[model samples]
Target: MTDSGALQKFLDGVVVDAAVFSLRPDYRAVLLPVDGLVPGPSDEASEALLQAAEASAREALAGRTVEDLPHVVAWREAYKSFGAKPQRTRNSLEALLRRAEAGLPRVNRLTDLYNAVSVLHQVPLGGEDLTGYVGAPRLVRATGAESFDTVAGGVPVVEHPDAGEVIWCDDAGVTCRRWNWRQGRRTHLTDDTTTALFIFDALEPMSDEALQTAADDLAAHLLRLGPDVRIVRRLIANDMTHPEGT
Candidate 1:
């Protein structure tokens, strides 16, 4: 299938809506819609990519720390503005970079690919199962009333984000807390996930060209999952209008 065909399949089951508000004027986001995935354990080729990405990350980190990286510094400040302790709850990009400095764990094919890309590009990237989505996926300030499904003490539990927190949610509840800190269990990607939404969150110092490059890389890697895979992409910015008819 073509990229548009895969994107249409992903959009068939649910409406995906997203926006960025109350963020620094330089904040940017790229949303990639993909469908016809065959999620499963990491194959040898995928593992090789992950390994190469880790090596690249390690080499990049050799001269400086994660905090010194412009992208990570912007994210840390963004988290601080939202009342999140960056040291305690590191953003996904920071966490992944730190792990890469040591070694990256092989999760699954989908997870490994995204994680590798995130570290390599120095951007926060996430994949969520669209089939599990309740309604349109949105990025808005949390009201502290949306329920977030998570695991606590090895058991499932529900939690809520602080009022005015930056979050990604659907009609059901928070899909990700603190922009990219923690992902809810409800919409997490799994081996059965056929359609998925990938989020690439960016700030200043991360240019539009960089964002597009990351999205393109992800789309290409996703195609490795199956010949029938499809993908669609959109860029969300403070100055841009809603992505429609384009």
Candidate 2:
């Protein structure tokens, strides 16, 4: 599962120790099952979770103005390392909400909740169906020439070159999700998803705690939206890209 040929040649002297998280259910260590396209939010628990996230954002920004808002516009626009630019213009929770509400194909509770936090935190957040995901959930710095199979509109998978950093959802010669400022559409959550691996990052020394808290909050939000969701703190040796001062 390690890199080789062109990838190996390019990354020759640089050996990066990737910190990966294996998220599997106690009963099913191979994968976590989540119903695709069907988010359990149709039930009372799901509704409460959605309302809670909505309420939290409203409260957090209760006193903040538009300009004062720490939106991820800069991160979104600048995060084109994968070479594909995400087409989100309105970069705000409110804007995305309006778009979704206007009926842009709502899938499952997990998807909805994850997207909600994305706008709320103003950071590029995403959750993947870990059931089918393989290998390590390590962040990778691609080099040389490599292609990964992804499903966002299903075109050329995102490319990570040597020295360029991106998240890997694999063990070797593989990448799970790339953290290019924007979220990946391939491993997006759906009603069919039973288990998920979420990424809520604050790549700064001061923001480590903040990111962790945000991730936890997001997990809770999702659990409330879907079936039982229990989160455990995961440590990745290669998680340097997350906290400040690798």
Candidate 3:
């Protein structure tokens, strides 16, 4: 388990810049720093969760397209506000939903579990290796100078976000680009990850009550991943931070 003080300090450093809030005043993010996870390759349990999520996605899209969902529409507008073409640069939620129609990726135990939660709850969720982070996480509009490590044409390369692009970063450049569109390679979760940071992005049409329900479900499932799983969460909105339990 992480030291309580250290974990609190890390959470304290999480912030959403005023520029980002100015772009979308309705934005809210739930940051969860969890520890004591039991990580491994995906097994029967995780596969079952993925199957259930696929069914949920199919049910949601039964008579409608992915773009017809209100939450997805809000996210698309959010992307366009920052000069991104939503169709070309799809947000994580939309991408997941589109793929979930066929099936969700089974990366590993840790990632598979969160992906399932994301699809089941209809939220854009991101998970990172807590230990890989050089500093705490923050959301800001990029200046087009930060280095984002990613693969291009099957080769490792560094890329930079366009100026005014919304991004999640720390002292070590960008961690995620275009809001929740894509996560950098630096802090991605792995099969051995035991400590992780999860980002849940929300906007209008998704109430705080609903977001809390999703978080509650994810936490309940995570508790079964390990005997000593420990979790600390906070909600950041309107430039203010509230500890999970007050």
Candidate achieving the largest lDDT: 3
- Give TM per candidate: 0.90, 0.54, 0.96
lDDT value for candidate 1?
0.82
lDDT of all the models against the reference? 0.82, 0.44, 0.90
Question: Cα RMSD (Å) between model 3 and the true structure?
Answer: 2.2
Better of 1 and 2 by lDDT: 1
Name the weakest run of 10 consecutive residues (lDDT summed) in model 1: 12-21
Relative to the true structure, candidate 1 reaches a TM of: 0.90
**Of models 1 and 2, which has the larger TM-score?**
1
Per-residue C-alpha lDDT of model 1 across residues 1-246, encoded as one tens digit per residue: 345765655444333233344557677788887888988987897788888889988888887888999999999999888788899999999999888866888878898899889988989999998778776777787789989999999999999999878888887899999899999998898877878899999888998899899999888999988877878777767644333422
Model 1 residue 226 lDDT?
86
Each candidate's clash count: 1, 31, 0
* lDDT-sorted candidate list, best first: 3, 1, 2
- Which regions of candidate 3 are displaced past 4 Å? 239-246
Model 1 ranges off by over 4 Å: 1-20, 240-246
